[model samples]
Target: MKSKVIERIAAKILIEKYQLLENFYPDLLSGITDIIQKGKIASRFPYIEMKEDEISILIKAKELSELKIIELWNNQDTEEFRALCSIYFDIATLLDKDFEFKNEEEIYELIKIISFGYLGEHNHFVKNYLISKKELIENISVPEQWNSRLLVTIFKGIVCLVAKHSWKDIDNAVILINQLRKEQKDFESKFLNTVNEDSRPYGSAELVSLYHFAKTVEILGQYLLEGRVNGNEFDIENKIKYHLSVAKEFANASANIVLEMLYKYFEAFSIKLINIKTMENKVTPNQIIELINSLPDSEKHIFIENGKYWVTQEWLCGAFAGRAFVNEILEDAVQEMIDYLYKHIGHDSMVGNSVTKSGFPNLERVKQYCTPVESEQD
Candidate 1:
C-alpha cells in the first residue's frame, strides 16, 4: 500500500476504534481528533513535521490494552513510538484517575519526549489534564538513581503549562509554583555543592531551569494581579509580592554563577513593580527604590569598564527610568537608580534604548536619563 493510503487507513481505524471506546472512555475520540488536528497545524512550522508512521503507531497503540501499551512504550525507542506514548498518556488521564507509568524513569522519558520532541500538539491537553493532577505530580517520588536534571525538566514543563493557564485554577497554580520554588532551591543547593569553580560556568542547566520557573511564577503573579480576585486587594498584592520575592531570591542565588540572570530578574521585577505602582496604587516610589537598593552591589561592578555594558542591564535600567519619567513621584528614586547605573556603566553606551525603542511614554524625559548611543556619542 502507498504510505499515504496506509496512513489514512490507520487514521480511520484509530478514529473508529476511539469512537467505539468513547462510550466507555468519555471524550476519548474527540480528544484524539483534537490532537491530530492540532498536530497537523503545528507541523506547518519548521523542524516539527508529523510523519505518517506516527498515525500508524497511534492506531496500533490505541487498540492494545494499557499494560501492552506500557510494554510497547518500554520497548520502542523510535520517534513515532514516543509520539504514541505522549498520546497514550494524554488519553490515559481521561480514562484513569490513578493512572501512572511503571516508574519515574518512564515518566521522565515521556516528559522528555513531550518537552523536546514532536509532541507540541499534546502539550495543551496534557497541561490541562495535569492541572487537576496536582497531587499526582506532587506525590511522585524521585529516586536517587534518576537524573535530577531530568526531573527539573519535567517540572519546568509542568510549571510553564500551569503558568500559562493559571486562570484555570489560581490557588492550585500558586501551590504548584511554591512547590517548584522549594524544589529549585533544593536542587541548586545540591548541584552547587558538587561543583567547583571550573565547572561553575558550565553548570547552567540548574540556573536556566531556575530562570524559566521563576519567570513562570512571575507570569502567574502578573495574571493574578490582572484578574478579578475573590479576595481583597491586599491579599492579591501580597501574593504578587510573594512571587517577586521568589524571583529575587533566585536572582541573588544565581548572580555569582550567571550574572545575566540578575539583569533579567531585575528587568522583570521592575516591570511588575511598575505595574503595581501605577495600577494597584499600593507600591510607593520609596518602596521601589528600597527594593532596587537591596540588590547586591557586587554585581554592578561588571559594567563599570568601558565597552563592558550588557544589553540586559540596559533593559533593567530602562524599565525603571521610563517609569520614573512618566510618573513624577517616581522621578527622584528612579533617577537615583539610573545615576548609580550610569556612574558604573558610563554614558558611552546605549543605556535606555530598549525602553525608548519599546515606545515608552514621556520619551523626551526618558532619553534625558537613559542617553541613547547617538546622543552620548554626539
Candidate 2:
C-alpha cells in the first residue's frame, strides 16, 4: 500500500482508539475524512526515507488490536510511532487552519513527540508546528520528565525568531532566550541536587543545553549589532546595546557554572587518583597550579589561591586545550568555555585587556565591541 494509505489508516485507528478528535474536536472529524477522501491533505511525512522496520510497523498497524496500537503510539522510541503522530497533526491542521489545541495535555504531548523528532532530524513541519503554537508554548507548564524536551523545543523556536529578522521577532527572541536561560539553570540545579554524590560532575545534557542557549544569545547579540549598523528602518541601537549586555550576562553566568563544574571534576579526579596509591605519577594540586602558571600572561588571571580556583578567558582557552584530561561528560563544558571566550575576547578588536578581569565576562568590554566604528555612518 502507498504511504498515504497507511498514514490515513493509522490516523483512523488513532482517532478510533483515543477518540481525541471525537472528544476534543468533534467538528474536525468529517473535515479530516473529506480531505483524506479527496486527497487534499498534503503529504507531511518527514523528508527522510523510511526504514524498512518503520514501513513494516505502519503496514502491520492495521492488523493490530487497539491496545497494541496504543502501545505503538505510546512507544516514542520507535520511528513508526513518531511518523504516525506527525501524520495525525498534519490531518488536524488540514481540517482546521488554526489547529487550536484545546488543552495543556495535548500541547505537552505534541511537544514531547516533536521535540524527539527535532533532535534527530531537522523537520520543517515540526518546527512550523512549534512556531504556530508560540503563545501556548510559552504559557504551558511542562512535566518533569518532559522538561528537557520542552527546553529543546523552546531553543529551536528562539533560533527561528533570529532567522526571521523582524524587530518584533528579535525582541521576542530576546525575551524567550533570557527565559530559556533561567529555565535551564533551574533544571540543572534540580538535576544536580537529585544525584546522590556531592562531587559528581554536572549532567552532560544540562551542560549542552546551557551551552546552546548561551551561544545562541551571543549570536543574536551580534545580529542585533549588524542590524543597527546596516538598516535605518528600526532605530534599535539601545536595543542592540541592551541585547549585547544581556548576552554578556548570560555568557558570564554560563562561564561561572562551567568553571565551577570543571574545578569539581578536577578535584574529584585528583582525590580518586590520590586514593590509588599503587599508581605512580598521580595528578596533584601543585601540578595543576604549575600548569596554570605556565599559561600565557593574558591567562594569568586564572589561579588557585586558598584552595579556590578562578577562571578567566585565557584560562578557559587553556581548559579547552587540556580538555582531553577531563572525562567525556565534561566535554560540553569545555566547548562552552571556548565559545564564551571567542565571543567576548577572541574576535573582538576594540576591547583592551582590563586590570580587574574577574575571570567572568566584562560587560563594559562587550559594550565596547558593540560601539560602531567611525567609518560606518549612522
Candidate 3:
C-alpha cells in the first residue's frame, strides 16, 4: 500500500467525476445540497451526521487526490473510487478498459480500491467480455501483479459456473466451469511459476490473500464440478443446498481475507519500530503514539500514524465480518508481532490482548453457522 505518485490522472478523473456525474446523476455541483441535510446514506465506514454541505466531501476528495501514493494508499481512501468506475464494472475489469492514465500509480490506486471489496461488486460485463478480458489480462506480464483482480475474476467465474449447476442446469454449468477452470489454470500457472515466499512481486500479501481466497472457492468449485455441490442428487432441495454451501464458503473467505489485505502492509513497520537495540521491548498503539509524541519539534515525523479510515472488527452482512472482526484481527496481529519481537530480542513478558471494546458486538451472535470446517486431508 506504499504509494508514491507524481502524476494522478486517475485522481483528476475522479475529481472530474463530480463534473461528469452531473450529466447522468444530476446531483453534485448545482444541487441545493440535500446530502448534508438528508435522511441518511449508509457508508462502509462509520456514518456521521453532516454539519457541513455535501460539496465538502468532494472538496476533501480533491485534496486527497493530490497526496503522494504512500499516504493515499495507507489511508486506502474511499474517494479513490469516487473517480475510478466502481458501478461501471466489476473489480476484474475496473481497469481493463482504457483510461487516460498518466502513470502506473494511478492503475495501482484504482486496483487497491477495487480489490478491497471486489467480491461485493458484481461484474456487470461478465456475460459480454469475461473470456475476452481473460485473453487481454494474459498479456499483463505478471499474475501476482494483478492479484486481487485476478481472484475476483476467477471467483466471479466460479459463481457464474456453479450458479447454473445449482439450478439443475448441469449441462450448461459444467461446460462453463470447464472453460473457466481451463482459463483460470492458465492464468494461475503464470503467477505461480514466478512467485514464492521470497521472490514475491509487489503486493505479495494481497497475492497470498488472493491465493487463499481463490483456493477456498476452487475447493467448492471442484466439489460442484464433481457433483458434490449438493450431494449428487439434482433435486430442487439439493440445488438450494448447493447454492447455500457456496454462499457459506464465500462469506467465510471474504471475512478472513479482506482485512488481511489491509493489515499486511504494516509488517515491516512493526518490525522496525521495536527492533532497535535499546528499545528491545513490545509496543502497543498507545505506546507507539506516546513515543511519536515524545519526539522533538524539529525531528522528522514518523511515517506511521493513526489510520484515516476507522479499522473495525465487526462485520454482519454475513459470516464474522463488520468492524469488530476487523479490529480484533488487527489488534491481535499488532500485539502478537510486538510480543514476538520483544521475545525475539529477549525482553521480559510484554504482550497484549485484543478485546472487543466497540463496534457491532461479536458477530457470532448473529451468524447461524461457524467458519467453514477444515477437515484433515492430504
Say which candidate scores most in TM-score: 1
Q: Residues 1-378, candidate 1, lDDT per residue (tens digit)? A: 699999999778656544433433453343555555445454456466546654543443354423333445434445444444445554433334234543534454334333322222344555555566555655666543212443444354444444344233444445555665666656666676677876665455435544544455445444443332243434544554554455445445545323233333333333333443355333222333443344445234123233232212333454444222222223233434444443533344454454344333333343344443555563
Error of 3 at 213 (Å): 1.2
Error of 1 at 43 (Å): 27
User: In model 1, where do residues sit more than 4 Å from their true spots?
Assistant: 1-135, 142-168, 175-189, 196-200, 217-221, 224-378
**Cα-based TM-score, every candidate:** 0.29, 0.28, 0.25
> How good is model 3 by TM-score?
0.25
lDDT of 3: 0.35
Q: What is the lDDT of candidate 2?
A: 0.40
Predictions ranked by TM-score, top down?
1, 2, 3
Candidate 1: count the clashes: 0
- Candidate 2 regions exceeding 4 Å error are 1-132, 142-153, 159-166, 180-187, 198-202, 217-378
Model 2 residue-pair collision total: 0
Could you give the C-alpha RMSD of every candidate to the true structure, in order shown?
Answer: 18.9, 21.7, 23.4
Residue 27 lDDT (model 1): 39
Best by lDDT: 1
24 Cα displacement, candidate 2 (Å)? 36
Per residue, candidate 3 scores C-alpha lDDT tens digits across 265-347 of 22221122112212333233333323323434312222223542122212212223222111223334333433433332322
Residue pairs with backbone overlap in model 2:
none
